[model samples]
Target: MTSFNSKKSLRRVSFISLSFLFISSLFIQGCKTGTKGIESGSNTTLEASINQGRNVFENSCAACHSFERDGIGPNLAGLTRHLSTEEIIDFISNPKKVIDSGNKRAVNLQKKYKSVMPSYSMLGKEKLASLVSFIHTYKDVPKPVDINEEGILEDPIPHQIEKSNFVVNLEFSFQIPASNEELPNTRITKLWGQPNTNEIYVCDINGKLYRVKNNKPEVYMDVQALMPNFKQRSGWATGFGSFAFHPDFENNGLLYTTHTEPIGTKNADYTLPEGLSGQLQWIVQEWKTDNPKGKTFKGSNRELFRIDMATQAHGMQNIDFNPTAQKGDKDYGKLYIGIGDGGAVQMKFPEVANGKHSPWGSILRIDPTGTNSANGMYGIPSDNPFVNITGEKVAKEVYANGFRNPHRFSWTNTGKMISANIGQHNIEAVYVIKPGANHGWPTREGTFGINTQESVRKIYKLTEEEMKDGVTYPTLEYDHDEGNAVCGGFVYTGSNIPSLTGMYIFGDILKGKLYYADESQMEAGRAIDFKEMRIALDGKETTLLEMTNNGHAKLRIGKDANGDIYLFSMNDGKVYQLVSEK
Candidate 1:
């Protein structure tokens, strides 16, 4: 119930309180041989296998992995130093074999990343060997970075989150078409029902917006087909990030969308000062359709703004309107956009994500129809927190600042804005954001103070002399041991599940596990205790991981006009409706 307040110096595997769940991967190095450099022992390094491996890596592995640094998957640069070619190939084919072995190092790897690297067993031995051969090229692992070796909690929240009294039962309701042929067959992000109608709309990262009728989806808008320069890389939330319909869609038929373009598609409005490399640009576009009720979109598009990022990996996640706002309310029709740091701080360019005006690490509120912004494309609300501030290029559109990745945001019944912020190294947080409040990123994670200069990966106790003031922390938080990423959910207003009414239900995007906090009990400056929500699949006891071929869940939440909730997997393109609560 305390106010917004409050790890170690280690490489990717910091022994801090953050809990990782994915089977610890690459425990391959802590073998009997110790940390000696390893060499591949197979003849599979032929040119063909290497090239095929490269292709497979781009299409499959690239989404969660890389050689230079850590990602959702472990950095592969030094992977060969611990395990031989055969061992790695075997692990990649069926990672669970080693994960299930209960190796201390292996389990810790799971706890560190809190994510499972999908097995490539379907590729068979030939492709698997090729992939390992390709990975073997990066033989030198970078030395671990452990900056401050003091005041770290091995387990952040030592006590287990209690299980809820309600068990949600899911029924298979519908499916979106496949966006790709690999691990995430579908790249759906949001599935929201149209206001005052039975119509439902969903969007995919590969650039398709679908309108569902009678449980069937038809293409509503195709951003990729419409824009030739549109780029969609597998990782880092590039391409068709999210979309929002104007509150007056029935009359205005105006829709807004966020997508990405290649690094140099054009000059960006939010460009880095200098010396920092610009990876890509996250864009916001406004579209107008002549017919709002039509199945196919017939519209014209206009670019609202483009933001340049230092690197990939957290550009834009979601853009939405205040659903609870009525037509005449001041909050009505104002768009809330979630903008991430774009890996700038971790890349050592803290300046890009340093302040509110930069717009890299903040939640922005704008009037889509107004024209008061510097760019003249949108309106900075007259009452935006930073609107009247003078000096140093102020981004007047910023409502609240300090978020690494404000992945999702939804309003509670009381008009409180709850945002789920995906963390770095440790802590996934849910915050009750207020205007101008800084949610401290680069300076803090959850309640722990982190030194960005020394090591972004390590944590230290919050010290007044060592930290800045005015940083707002999360009302609800969990370490990586519980889940890697937070997929936001809404405050259920539907009548189907009376128990869920007034409750905010959400889940882990990586683990497909469910969680919730009663919004009725939420109050100012109070720490909310959330519990794990149990689920049943189609009348049978099951988990989201069990419902998939791979161990990952790639989970996301959605809702119908009636306020009933829906669960869908990004891995398989299937959407499930909440049928009952027991």
Candidate 2:
């Protein structure tokens, strides 16, 4: 097992690499440099180039070093005084080589900073020149705006993206009884509960579900133990994934889970091609507790249904019960499962990408309460979009199709389902998922058309009619410039934070940035103008990245019975509740 510290280092390096790749791609396309100097009109052109460089710096270098003061790396303010622009570019591109060559400044800097500087080898000459230009012109570095006494950003950036009104506060720390120590910093994927229950249930990527009561966690289930061949890859597949309690849990004591189960001696619903070995299949099982109101759980488990995962990652991740669907309703007692395209990306497999009969790339709705079915242990809802269709390869269980990885989806109290679909490489999108909606996965990423034959960075606009048809474009989407992973959030209806009430809040797992959109606008089928959730710790402005202590572990959003929202840091075993400004 990789230690926590080593994982953090790996993530830091990975992020820097990704940032350079993204910014370098930008540089190749747009950042053509002209004559560069600090002279007046020269300053205008230079500033434009510098601004482009600044974007790269903020996204890549700013995480470690700042211009104002020493951080992970030495302060770059007036760095030109110590090194020439050529020397700086050389160091940025080849820090290890410079340091290893026994260069005095490089050695001294390495001595000053314990961590080794990552090399931006991927950055080509022009991009390096632009970065060097920004450093050369550095003046007094502008500090990040601090939070006011009311916990708002001291200086709000003008325009659409404003800071959030609320801040994140640690709710509790999990201590496992068996280990007799705090659990390792495993990624917490979901925090959920049954209706009218004070207790909260949290799941880790390792497949341990914990029941928290009085701020302590006890093992509710070891989901991994049940699957003999549960496969896991570092930083890729989620082990336990997610679970949802039946809305009538108080009476039924039933809950459901989505996980990757290895194909053992038992027959699998599907399997990888002949060459593949030791792969896992998606499992959606019904687990019933002995007492639904009890603090601890003793469960009886039964297999509801299973599907084969053609891809190692992007297996079934989210499962939820629609809170708005009541008894006797067509949707009542139905569970919604979100499945990725199973690696149909870049049209790796045409069947996975274009086959309507395949359930690999869609949201499936099924009646877990009923056992009557052709092959599946659960009942397929008659109202499913593909259920009635015949003579097609389409799986009858599909509710909605055409999403890459709908990692998380939730239904609001008002019956609206929202999804945060993880993009292939460039975009992260949020969608108001309508029944039978096609989100355009292999064909599109965000609003851009994807070439099924080859992956291209450029995005093409969808036709007006295509946007109006069954295909739904993103309600809100951000390019890779903003974030990579979109963690879906809930619509707040809680009274504790009146300002946050009726707002749909979400965050980026990689950047730890929180954003919210007005719920009213979302319900009206309009795109949202998302604003950043400005957070302050001890009156100092900060990002969720600083709060969580790990940048890569996903920042998950959660909700309790009261409708109050919470943020769970997968980096640390701490749960944070979103609260009103003190």
Candidate 3:
């Protein structure tokens, strides 16, 4: 039995040797073919080889070694001069063999690095050559700018966009009641800009829309006229809400606004309610522009859509028409709306505690031109994720899901979608949307586990493989401990602020702090590491600027036609431009 075992072992060794030989032959062939693509001129060949080598190094070597800085191993800035390309390739492809063969360099490198450079025997010979080429060309020259300046700014221009600047200088402010007694319950929940009139629209918790122009405030619309008992029935006093103008508002005069409407009334003693009582319902209404060219809207209004709330508190609503979207055109026109999961405060009401309703938490992409159905108010887009899926009663307008209070979202100048989700008690998040991503909200908050029905249903616990299959995760996120509420802002494609260009500007509702996150922070496949962000104010003494008694805080940041940034305060009823204190 011992003799038979020995024979079998010998046969196994022989087979392995033969397999290695075959692979080696294939590797050599791949390398030779790859060399053919290089130019014959020595300089050209060297440069081409170096470029290829850099790609290989970044993908394979840089993870282990840094050319000038320490990574997993020592810097290798001049490694090529110490080892020939052939020797380097052999050592990389079979480090153990070279070390055992008594090659001093390999032996020393292994000992000093304290980690064996793993063999890349499976890599084609061409790839190995490219990698060696990259090593040969590496230099230890200092970068022209401070290495720390890497993501701070990309553009060299110093001026903001010209046309955008014009809008920036057109200043205006809103007037709040001088005495708290006059408007004891007033809360400015949101503010909107009318691109056509260049005027600002403000919505107060008291159910009034005020128009501000030339630093004066006038009533734009009063809810009591439309809904007789708005103050008692509308839950606008509790959450984030917004208004939007149709893309063709200049000509069509159609407007849409989102507010919390009461679902029904209930007896103070009822045990179990039939419909939501004092619950917030997301209502989208349309009103004519009264005077398309005027500062105020005065006309008959119609309700477009009213989504019943799962809970009242966390229901945040934001609306915007795609700036790049063209009207009268079928495929391009769209109204993007964000809905928050019913209030993040768990167990505020018995129904929410029982899990019978869905909290307002999702990004809804809809077409407003079609019939009202589960799919949307408009004809469903053929390209919508669920449009072609068979055997499911899914809503096509649901572009993505699993968001908790997506208070704000915007499309980049290049048309990429980004959003900020207000977390429950633990975290706040920012996500970039791909076609049909599931953001994993109540089930998972900011990439961490949370105990919710969605978590129990296996909706939030996605394995890495499942996440890979679909489900785009957030590009950025932060803990509530850092900032209580996240306010989403725009990407800096504006030309004026050189330092702010390419950065994303965002703020916190409670902290009143402003932040600038670099574009790289928006990259996919990585968790946003926010330690590198630049805060606009030092943490010690600066307080976030609050709006005057208008019950409005600095609610939203706006950009003019020129790309300059402006802060709109709901409490102060004022707009402030971000200019150089210099």
Candidate 4:
């Protein structure tokens, strides 16, 4: 009886080993068949369907399912081994129907996984078959290849700087927005250009300067040094709001900057109390760099001029050396500055002077070489609109009036000055700056009716002519549905991307999409045609590449030293070069 039992146990062990070998052979055969089918294109229809299925899976299913790990849904390992193609098709088409029918696998899946699977019935028969075939092929998936071990580097590595005939090595280092704190919060408000080096400069809301070199970045100047008192007081708002390098920066290390001052007796507005006086105020200072080379920029520091600002918030202090004029000429030193309408809405002693804020809400054109105005700072240009006007107590420097907060204004490639004004509740607008123009703000938002009556009693009242003249209509405007705040962008002059060339690229800070407006579109005075700009990752459109922290897209579309388009993600601090696949 013992010998018979031993023989029976050996037979049972042999049968089990045979069964395991058979299953292994079947898996190996399936893998071989799949590989051959993929190579020969024998399963072309199925493979194409699989590719389509993969796209749908990435966009819709990848969020839940994983082959090796269970995420929102169950792991799909060995699914093909148990379910037939017809059954999978039925289940995928309507998972609820299968579960209701009391199918063993469906009922078990429903019990084990409380979440119900969404139906893919919209995917018709042929497409469903392709997806099923793709699933069947993945039964015994191969391990991912180790590219480093295999010595296959497919993507273009940044370390390798390839030469190109179309490349243009621009001279000046581009400017990036900076903050006093290590983490920058303010958006880029304006951008200016420096001569000879062709370098671009940008000013942020917090008031800091950063220079971009070879697509890399470095801090150029600290605002804390200029506003020592403000640094000691707020510590938060202590930075240069804007800066402009002299046209002849090579000879004269002169530069100008605008910033908020420590609040003494007055707030951001210049309203002062009786007998209680505060000297500290927001001022534009002229400074010289110790280093004229501008390359190392280690120990550069010098003072040139200063202009006291009335308020902090609405002050649009942007200075730029006239590009049209020649450098080194004494009379060629002209600076254009745009100030905002005095602080918060209120009819106060200083704010209601002569029925308007005197020098506030106007553009000032000044000559920095003369010795007529404040120490170091120069007098107004002779051509200023209000310079010779009598009986009116307007400052000689006032060029235009009625502006609220002119965040940024730029000269087009053709030299046309365009300004973007931040609106109140209804609209944000873009305007062409005329020498004596009055942009209606506070009184009106865009071309809409004035915000007058008992509600806005404290604000200035507008006449019929002034109401019409005060409001400047935007060249292009979009509702808040499009974007919360607008970030102005430059026209693409990059050689690598032809489709983007000659198009003005601007974006909304809240929305990560880059909008392309053609020059012709703007010239026609019509609505700008826009499309959602997409980034390609491994030859596919993916949200993973676009989205950042909290699903907020922080996109900085800028140009490289060679005029090639490069995008930076503020959240990840990663930079990407745009390339077209041949």
User: What's the TM-score of every candidate structure?
Assistant: 0.88, 0.70, 0.59, 0.55
Tens-place lDDT digits, model 2, residues 122-197: 5566777777676556544332221122321111212335665566433343433332122225657888754576
The local distance difference test score of each candidate is: 0.75, 0.63, 0.51, 0.46
Off by over 4 Å in 4: 1-195, 198-208, 232-238, 265-280, 296-312, 322-324, 327-332, 346-357, 374-376, 452-471, 520-582
Which parts of model 2 have CA positions greater than 4 angstroms off? 1-184, 263-265, 270-278, 456-458, 463-469, 523-525
Error of 4 at 231 (Å): 4.0
Report residue 137 deviation for candidate 2 (angstroms). Answer: 45
> Per-residue lDDT for 218-302 in model 3, tens only?
7776664576424232212242267777878777787777665455421211111233223445666667866777755677776
* Superposition error at 340 for model 1 (Å): 0.8
lDDT assessment of candidate 1: 0.75
lDDT of 2 at 262: 56
- Comparing 2 and 4 on lDDT, the stronger one: 2
- Candidate closer to the true structure by lDDT (higher is better), 1 or 4: 1
lDDT per residue for candidate 1 within 507-537, as digits (tens), equals: 8887888888888776534578988988898
Per TM-score, the best of the predicted structures is: 1
